[model samples]
Structures are given as C-alpha cells and as structure tokens.
Target: MGGNGKHRWKISFHRPSSSSSSSKMEANHHNHHKQQEEPPKDFLCPIYGALMADPVVVSSGQTFERLSVQLCRNLGFSPKLDDGSIPDFSAIIPNKAIKSAILHWCDSSGVVHPRVPDPATVEKLVRALMAEEEVYPSPPPFSSPQLRVSERELIRGVAENPPVTFSHAATELGPRVNHFYSSSSEESVVITADNPGTPLPFATRPLCYSSSSSSEITESETLASSIPNSAPASEEEDHLVRNLKSVDVVDQEEGVLSLRKLTRTREELRVLLCTARVLLALKPLISSRYAVVQTNAIASLVNLSLEKPNKVTIVRSGFVPYLIDVLKSGSIEAQEHVAGAIFSLALEDDNKMAIGVLGALPPLMHALVRSESERTRHDSALALYHLTLVQSNRAKLVKLNAVPTLLALAQTGSSASRVLLVLCNLAACPEGRSAMLDGNAVECLVGMLRRNELDSEATRENCVAALFALSHGSMRFRGLAREARAVEVLREIEERGSERAREKAKRMLQMMRGRDDGEDEEGDWEKALRSGGAGGVGRNLHGPNSTTF
Candidate 1:
C-alpha cells in the first residue's frame, strides 16, 4: 500500500510530454503575429507610414516622425494624410510620452524597435509626394454659398480692373512707341497743327529727343505735347513681362532693369507692377546663371516691395523662396538686395511668420555672420531683429544656436547695437533665456556695460533690458551676474543711463538681491512685458524710424 502511494505521488509531479511543450510554443507564436499585425495606429507616422522612432507634436497638435516634419518644412510642402487632414509644421514639440508608449508596446509585442529613417530615402519619398500633389492638387474645402459668391466677386473685380491706366493717346500709341508716361496726369490732348482740314496727329517723341528749329512749337502746342506721347502702364508692364519671359538672356536683363527703374520711386507704379503675371515672369530670372539678370531681378523685387500693400503681395506670389535661395548662393551684390527685400517684407506684421516658416532663418543667420558685405550684414541683422519678434521664430532661432553667434558679435562690436536688439527679442522667450544664460550672455552684456563699450544710450538701454528679461525665474542669472560684477554696472546705469535703462537696472538689482517680491516669478514678468511694462521687447520693437528699408 505504501509503494503504491509513492508511485501515485511521483506520477502527479511528472514533467509534460514533448508534444504538449511544442503546442505551448505554437500558441505564443500565434499571439506574436496577432500583436504585430495590429499595433497601435498612433505609433505610426502619417507621412512615413511606419513606426515613428522619434515622434514630435506639431502646431497642428498631430504627432509625426520628427524627420518627416523637418523634410516637409524644408521643402515648403504641407502634406495631406490618409485621413484628409493637413499638418501645420510651423512649430514642433517632442512627444516624449507617446515615444515611451511606442517603445513599450514594441518590447511587449516582440516587435523590433523602429530606427530613424535614412535622410536621403526620406527626402526622395517627400519629393515624390510633392510631385503627386503638384499633378493632382487638392480640392478646396466647402464654404457657404454666400461666402463663395463673395469670394468669386472679389476675384472677378480684381481681374477686371487693373490698378493703373494710361491716357487715351498713350493707350493709342500701343507697341508703336516703346516710351511710357513719365507723369501721373490722366488727360491726353491731341492738337491739330495750325490746319484744321488736314488733321495731323500729335507726333510721338522719344524721351531724350532735343528741341530743334524744325521741332520748335508754340506754348499751347508745347502744353498739349506735354500730355506725353507714351504707352499705357499696363502695356509697358506687359512689354517687360514678355521680355522677362523670353528665352534670350539679353531680353531678360532688359526687362529686369526696366522693372527696377520703373518701380524705384513711383509708389503707385510699385503697387501696380507687383501683379501676379509680372511676378511670375520675374521669378525665373532671380535664379538666372547670368550675374546681371539675377542681381537686377532681386533689385527689382526690392524696389517693388517698397509699397506697403506690395509687401504681402510679393510674399504671397511665391518670391520668398527665390529670395532665400539668393541669400544662400547669389553674388555678394545680389545678396545685399536680397537682404534688403527680406528686411522690407519683414516690416509687415503679416509677413514675419510666413518668411520664417519658409526656411528663411538659417540663410539669414548665415548672411548675418559670414557675409563680407556691410549692407548685407546690416539688413540681415535687421531682418533677424524683426523676424524674432514673433515667438515661433524666436524658438526656431534658439534651436539654430543663434545666441552664441549673437553674443560673439556683441563682444567684438561688430554690429553690436543691432545684435543686441535681436538678443532682447530672444530674451522675451523662455528657450531664448535658457540659451542666453548657457552662452554666458550675462557676463558678456555686463562686460559691455562695465566698459561703456556699447554704441549709444539706446544700445546700452537694450543691453540692460535683455538682462532684465533673462532674469525671470533664472537662478543661474543671479550667480552669473554676481560673478561678472553686474551689480556695479547696474548701479551706474541706475544713476546716469536713460529712463528705461534705469528702471530695468533697478528691477534686476532687486531680483539679484534675493528680494522675495511677488513680481520675481516668470509669469508675472511675462505679464508685465505683455502689458507694456518697462522691459517690453515685442510691443516696443517698431520704433518711429524702424521700418526704414
């Protein structure tokens, strides 16, 4: 009976058969396939259609692969995903939580972790998608009937009525005379020479013709002739348009030169000549291999962009990419004009964001630091100053490591005043503050203040303001300021500097002294700046003469 009991216990504790173990392994394999076949949808990027190695959230609040977002931004393409939604690539934030979730899912599901996609392969995919988009453009979204009718009417009105016209004689001159009206007067008087029976049309004369005995006229005839034997503005513009669209480089050069001359001083002509057809014709010449054509084309764009309305119109017409391209690779002369055009366009509040979005920051930064031309550096600095007024652009510049370059320039007094202005704007944002602190901006700025090396009271004031802006919630600033002996500089500014500088200096001193005033918090400082307090950078950027291009 005892032996039987032991046998029963042994049987109860025996190991499983080989077939049973094999069946358990098969079950696990099946579960692995099930998980691989249906991973979480959010783990995949809409643009890449694969697991995202590094996911980020864009301004549109959608997650995508960071490389994919960067490619779209650089190419200036906004992709439509399978869900028919378009992503805004203006701003990006890392989706750390989602990234963690994706990695965890991969580990648990026995799926291999995703790796960063190859840049060349990703670029090829993006270009192919862009080609498809070009071939088959997306349809417009639905709108109310009333809104649609209003839009149609607005477009038709713009199409039917040109911004400029010419006198009747000028219009009649047509292609016969290449001359154009030099005056804004609309009246055209045709005088019949002394005889009424055989009427003689007013003779058309070239702009540079000299008066001779045969051509001498009476006072009344001279007045009538002063009406100008010229072609309509539209006809002249069309002639330039044709030249710009010509295959020959000579014709293109002539067109761009004429455009530059015509739009240089006449505000009305600048507004009129900035039409879509004229811009389209002028676009290709901006990238021409011939130096004359490219320089004149960029200069013409600068002249045309002088008008207020033309600023936004030029950007909307797609001239920004060409301008940015010139900034990168054009001749030094052309780069100067390109910088001028960018500065002119950035003067408009509406254009600041678009210019930054279409990849203008990096090249502008390059021109600011590396260009040998003084005007190019000046305008490039001013353009950056204006561009960084927007928060998104400030963030982008910080990411580009602009603080160190700016600080270096400031230390050397190379465009120090303008460079400090950009720093002030950057200091308005949190990322800029952190970067500035990391770059030892406090010591650099304090050194300037201590030595009185800045250019003017305004520059000195801006340096103080930047320090004050950086002082918000920054413990590192206190220690750095102490080490740089900033307290003595602040004391001097508080005594003899401008009113704005004195005020900012006093506040920074208060913060450095470890005053527990409620105003020391970051939010309070931001609110104070936004509410037009002493250290406000964004709202006070546009000075009385700041818009000069």
Candidate 2:
C-alpha cells in the first residue's frame, strides 16, 4: 500500500442520528396540526377585533335598508350568519383579504348583521353548525322533503335570516339584541282597565235581584254560577233590598268603566305595527298562513319608524327593504337606521350591494350634511363605504356619478372613518382614482371644505384626509384636486391628518406647491390605488332628505 508513497482509504458510517430526526419530525407534525386548524373564528374585522369583540354596531343605515328589503327578499338565500360568512368560499372568496371581516352571530341573540352570505349558502353553514351532515333524504329524486314543521321553520330562520319566535326563548339575549313577534298566534285580549268588578264584554250579568246576605257578590264567577247561589227573598225586604242592590250595580258599572280605561289604554297603529312585528317573528309556528301575512306587515313598519315613542324599535329591525326605504326616502330617522343597519350588515357583501342599489349613497350624504352626532355622520359616510364593497356595484355607483357624493361625505363627514371605505371602492373600481376625480369629485370635495366654517374638528380632519386620498391614489385626481384648489384644502388636511398621514400631507404639499419637478403620478392612477388606498376616502354620507315613517 505504501509503494506509491500514498495510502488509499475509504470511510463509511450508519444512518444519521434518529433522535435528532425524530425531534424534527415531531416539530413538523406540530406545524402540520397548526396549519390544519382553522383561524380562531372571529366576528369582527382585524382592525377592531380586540375593541369590538362582541360585535361592532352602528345605526346610520335607516335610509339604506327599507327598499332593499325587497331586493333582499328576492336575494333569496339562507341566513345562517351575516354576509361575512365565507359563502362557498372553498374556491372563491369575496375579497376577505381587504378586512378579514366576519359577521358571525348566534341569531338567538337577535343581532342584525352585515355582509353575511346569502341564504342559500348560509343553509350549509347552519346545517354544519347544527352538526348535521347533508342528508339527501330521498325516495328518489324530486321527492317531498319529509321535513318537520319545526325543522322547516328552523331552516327558514337560519337560512333565510327570516324572523322566528322560540318556544321558551332558546335564543339568548344581549345588549344589542331584539326579539321578533308573531302576529297571528298572539292572543290580543282586550282587558278592561276602567272596571275590574264589572263583567267583561264577554261575560254575562247575574239575575239575582236580592240576596239579603248574598246580594253582594265577592268572588268572580260566571253569572250562571251566581244565579245558583242566590236565595229567594220576601216581598217587602225584596223591594228595599232591590234599592240597595241598585246602588251596588251602579257602583259596579263605574268600576267596570274605570277598569276598561286602565286595561288596554288603546292599541295605536304604531303599537299594532310593533305587535305585528313581534308576532311576525314568531313565524310559521303561529300559523302556516302567517308567514305570508308577515311579509306585508313588516314592510309597513318602514313607514312608522319616524314616529315618537315607537321609533326606538327601528333600531332593532335594520333589516332590508323596510329600513332601506327610509334611508332612500331621505328621512333623518332613515339615515340613523341606515347607519345602524350598515353596522348590522357591515360584515355582509350582499347587504352592502343591496343597500347601495337601494339608493343609499345619496341620502347618506344628505344625512351627513345636517348630522347631529359626529358618529352619525361617520356612519352615514360608512354606509357609502359599505356600498362600494362589491366591485360591480361600485362600478354602477360610478356610472351614476356617485363619486361626488361620496367625496363630499368623506370631506365633510367622519373624522375617523372619513375616507375609510369610499377610497377603498374608488381604488377597487374600474375607474381609477384619477377617473373618479375627472368626474368633478375633486371639485365637489373641495367645495365641501370651502363651505365649511372650519369649526368642526372632525369635519376638517375628514376634509384633509379625503384630499390626501384623492391625490394619493390617482395622480390625475390629485392634479384635478390642485385645479380644484385641493392643495389649499390639503393645507387644511395637513392641519387635521393623523400622525401616519403627515408624510402624505408633505408629499401633497410638495406636489401642490409645484415643487415635485417632473414625475408624472397621474398616468397610472389605478396602480396608485392598488398600492395602499383602494382609490379615495370612504365614509358614511347622510342625505338631506327626510321621510317620516
């Protein structure tokens, strides 16, 4: 071996360490388990997941939900959850990447929600929630579903998000929760408040003229029972007793009159509507025919929300169409309800689209114009914010020349949520932010700012951010802003923008002051929108119109 002045050698070893490999394998398995697990089911957007753990609600959508109820009624889907429910999301998701919003709720608690999947899809979720595997129960295809009445009603309630009443309130109650009523089955007994002693209209009068000792009937009994207990009286005493009994009879009549007044003060139309709503919620259990009756009854409530004392109930029923009419009608109450409904349906894409189609944007802006609360105006703006969630709907809104309204809302609307959603849509729309601005939206926004007395902190803040968004996403829109004197507005925006938005304000300042030399930011407005802003600011916009229910 040493002959060539070098030694040849080979080395070999057993397999690598099993413990190290096993530990790595275990770690991998743990990771795999984690991957398989679902994200903790949440009911709020990631932004407010911590603050609004129970649910985020608003009351500014009154105007948006009334007419849309018709659209929603036909939207024809199951209602296991709010629009945020992943609807057949296995393959297609409705852009959860934007907010990761979920409108999940236990209906037993009666929480109106937004952006939930349509009823058809929610049925699956309800079935799954109930731990029921789909059982294609069939004698063959096209057979009658031997569904129990309760099961059918249950499905109707869960899938369609229809009203329902429980046997003993299986559903729980919450601060924001409200219960529905069924009209047909509820016993509408008319109690006499004026007179407790007098016989009811349904009761009979006793015939005993004289019962020297028993003429005074102490206990309640049918007139028939009292007749049997009466004793025969002598002639002289009978006449004298008759006079005494007459006084008692007159007293009884007075008591009855007083009782009648106290009992059913009166069933006003509003109370009737409220009663109908409650009864309607009881659903098919009350009567098979009632389901059909309730639809009309509930639709009437939209006309009633603006009334005193009963308007509070509208907060409970931010349901579609009923409330949308009010929103579209341009009533202050409608705007409030629309805002509330927006929060209710914020988690739903269909709801947003439906409310939008119901002409919510216009009224929303009007509401913001005379808003009493900063939050109310913000919610009104948010209604518009919610409307643009659907891409096609947003496009339709653009075609309607709605950008001006939304821009106005953002500029003079919510300080915090000023451009939160409108911008998202403008960015999402086929119309680039620049295109939106070209439609005179920048002028409209700047106009809002110009009209302001500059007293409202929220309003000023909102205006600045809205301008920033206009210029931020689309160079064309930004240039248009400059033309509209939006640069001047930007100074105001700079004065009001959040700490995070200051750099943007500075950049706009440079651009507006004509300091940025040659870079063209307008050519690709769409790209700018895609980067951060969807396009411009999104906020609730209330309309000036008012419709009394």
Candidate 3:
C-alpha cells in the first residue's frame, strides 16, 4: 500500500505534457540561480557599501570611498568603516590596486567605469624618459596637445577626479611648465634622437594646453629661434617677454618662496630675482587687482630678500616704488605685505638710499600714524630705524615731522618698542638729538625704564644707547639725563645684562660721573659696582679720579 501511495504521488507530479514539464523545470532552475547571485564584494566600499570608483586605504587596513574619507577628515572625525571602526586619516593612501580592480570589474560587468588613466602608461613614460641607459625604445611622437592630455590624465588619475585635478595640476606644475614653455631643447633633443628628421613636438610653439592656438605658433617659433640660449636680455626685452608669457603668477610666487627657503644656489636666486622683476613690472596689480597674485608676489619678494644677492637684485629692479605705491593705495592686507617687504629690503645698507629716495617715508609715516594694525606700525618704524642709520635719511625724517609722530606712538601706542628704537637711531646725530630733546623723548624712555615695560632686550639696549648719546659730553645734557634718572637705569643694566650691554652701560655711567678709567687706576669702579648704595648712583669720587656732572 505504501509503494502504491508513493507511485501515485510521483505520477501526480509528472502528469502534465512533456514540453510543459520541461519548461516548468527550466523556469524554476533560472529563478533559483537568480536568487543565489549577489553583487561582488570586492568592488564595494567598506565604508559606504557602494561600488567604489575611487578607493583609498587608511592605516587600519581597510578601504573606503575617497570622498567619504575626505569628508570624515573635514568633519574632524576619524574615517569610519561600515562596522564602525575608526581609521587614521593622516595615514590614508591611494589604493591603486583596488581602484584598478574596481574599474576592471565594472568594465566586465557592463557598469559605467570612471575615466581614470591607466597608471601603467604613465609609469612607462616616466621610466623610459628617466632611464639610466638612454637607449630604450622611445614611443611614437605625440602632439603637444597629446602631451598636455597625458599630463592631465596623469594628474587626474592621481587626484581621482577631473575638475579639481586639472586646477591642482595647473597650479603646482610651475617648474615643469616653465621648462616646457621656455626651454624645449631637452624635449626636442629626445624627440629628434628617437626619430631622426621629425620636428620636435614642443619646438614650434609655446607649450600650452590650448590646442586651438595654431595661429600664434608661427610667432612663437620665430621668437624661440631668434633668442639665443645664453644671451643677457635688456630691461625692455624682459618687459616684452614677461607680457608674452602666460605663467600663473601665484604659482610662480609659491615656487620662488620655496626655492629661497630650500637652497641659496645662484641659479635659483637668479630665477627668483627675475621673477621679482616681472612682478615689479606688473605694479598696477599690487594696488587693487588680483589680490592673491599681489600678496603672493610681495611675500615671495620678502622671503627672497633675506639673501643678500636677492635683496640687491630686487632693489636694482625698482621694487621699492611698487611697494611704496601699495603702501599708499592698496587694501590694508596688501599694505601689511608691502610693509613687511620694505622691512626686509631695509636690511641691506645699500637699499636704504633707494628706499628713501623713492618716497617710502610718506607712506611709512601714513601707516605709522593712521593704520590700525600694530604690525604695520612696527614694521614701518623698523624700516625708518634702519633708514635713519644714513645721516641724510635722519634729516629727511626730521623734515617730515617724524620725531613728534614717533613720540606719540612711544607714549601711547602698542609699537612703543619699535618707536624707541627708531628714536635711538635718530639720536645718533646733532639734529636728531635736538629733535628728541624738544620732543621730550627722554621722558618717554625714562618712563619705559622705570615701569619695566620695555618689550625686549633690544628695546632696552637701544633706549640706554640713546640716553648715552644724548648726554655724553654736554653739561646741560648730563643734567637732563641725571634728572631723568638715567643713572639708575644704567646701573640696573650694568648689574644684570648682556656683556656688551653691561660694558656700554658702565662706560656711559663713568662718562656721566666725569671720570676716566685712567683716573680710577685702582679699580674703584669694581667696588662701586658691588655696592648697593642708592642703586650705585651715589658713589663719590672727588679726589684725583673725579669731576662732577
């Protein structure tokens, strides 16, 4: 009976037509297969669970979407995985292997693939061009536009996108672009050596990415051929070429500052100086146009001026006038950069005369009196200080009514230290001494000393030096110093100061007391220095070693 029941169930399962049964079995098998299929895990980002077009790896040994990781970093959080584990962002690296695998899988599975370049091609080109033996088989010549396209592709692949990548490449490719645009001899030689008799791809044009500039190619070729490799150019030639060149000034400025920081090689210095000249020629930009370009150029020139040769070159290029113009007409930000540039340029003794003659003082005085920025005021004062080391500059400053302006700052501004240093420099001459005395500079310096509010050792030293200069030989000046309590300050400095400061202080004190080292032959001053009576000001020497103040 059980066998008969099993036979009946089997017959019920297969009682339909043969074609219908086969078709039903086939449909069931297809549905089962579809139900078992799933998307490939390797192509999915561990963080976003989406197919990754641009995959990057972090230090925790996990892969994530590039945008997801960057977003996490921007939000000030560690990159998180789908499992909620945080990965270190700073150690994030490009997962080229995974990226290539993802593209491959997309291509095989009929999914839309990202437009990233094959890294293998770029690596091959880099290797062949930079090979140890120069005998490798060269690839066929690509057009200038093709070369640009290839570089663009390389940068895009590295950056993982198109638009951001293009901007970044154009910005950071300054040195390479300069090489291709201005000196194509190397590229030309390589192309000719690879295939004899073929014209170089970069030889007949300014190697720009714009493929539609054929009309200008003839002019570019003519200019390239006419200019010699080693000839020195006149200023007019420089101006013409600079106008013709299409380099990005902001990028070039960045390169210039970087070169100055890394090395002081003459070649780099020459390039930097040349860049400064070009920027100086574009002076109108410093006033109101291209704020980024103007600020970067100013900063680059400031850093380059730290080197003596660069400073000399920039000064000779007539940059002082541009800086002065900016100080007069630019935005406050630009004025600050110009002030800093002027201060750096003032370090060169030879630059002081040029700066003074070029009308730097009026803008500087304006900045000192009216600018709300303390840094601007400080830098202007410092430049004035360095410039006043030249006697004629001091006279010019006096004529500009600098004494009263600086005295006001010293009495009530945040730039008191810089003002006092300027006063010290001006006090080096007879006219400056009279100016300080009339402007009551002694009282200001004395107030600073008594309150212990001097900003730095340099400020204090300059203050003491100014006092010494003001009161060294004249009885009336000595009385002024004495009444202003200069002796008390000098004693304090002598007891605990730098070696040079102490020596200067002691000399000034001895001079104020009307005694010479020759008269104090027994080292009585040593005994006085140890004594604390009236802060060492009441020490009496009336016999052979003394005269009176």
TM-score of each prediction: 0.58, 0.36, 0.46
> What are the clash counts of all predictions, listed in order?
0, 117, 0
Question: Per-residue lDDT of 1-549 in model 2, one digit per residue for the tens?
Answer: 001112121211112243444587798985585455323334322211111222322221222111122222222311122321111110111232222232233232223333422445333333333333233322322222223234344444445553344233221111211222112121111223432332111100000000112333323212213232233123422332232222232322222222112111122432333432232232122111222122222222322322333343333233443444544543333344345444434434435544454445655655656656443465555455555656755675666666665555555543323453465456544474655566576676567666764443333433444455566544576457667776665576567644323445666778766665334544433343333232122211111112111
Model 2 alpha-carbon miss at residue 497, Å: 7.1
Off by over 4 Å in 2: 1-339, 347-380, 387-393, 407-435, 447-452, 485-502, 512-549
For model 3, residues 1-549, the per-residue Cα lDDT tens digits are 111111111101111233444587798985585444334666565434456667765533456667655544433333222332234444456777678887776565445664432345323422332242222222323211112233334434535632221222223212221111224321122222323432212111111211223333333234434444453346533543343222444433444333322222233433433543343333334442555556545644554554555554566544676678788877665676677677767766767765675568888988988976655665677677667768768888888878888877776776665576677667667788788888877777767777877665545555565665555334566667777887888788899854435766787688778774534522433333222111211122111111000
Residue 182 shift from truth in candidate 1, angstroms:
31
Better of 1 and 3 by TM-score: 1
Evaluate model 3: give its lDDT: 0.51
Predicted structure 3, TM vs. truth: 0.46
lDDT of 1 by residue, 183-209 (tens): 212111222243233211111111111
Q: Please tell me which predicted candidate would have the highest TM-score against the true structure.
A: 1
| lDDT per model vs. reference | 0.66, 0.37, 0.51
Worst 10 residues of 1 by lDDT: 2-11
Tell how far residue 241 is off in model 2, in angstroms.
53
lDDT of 1 at 441: 92
Count clashing pairs, candidate 2: 117
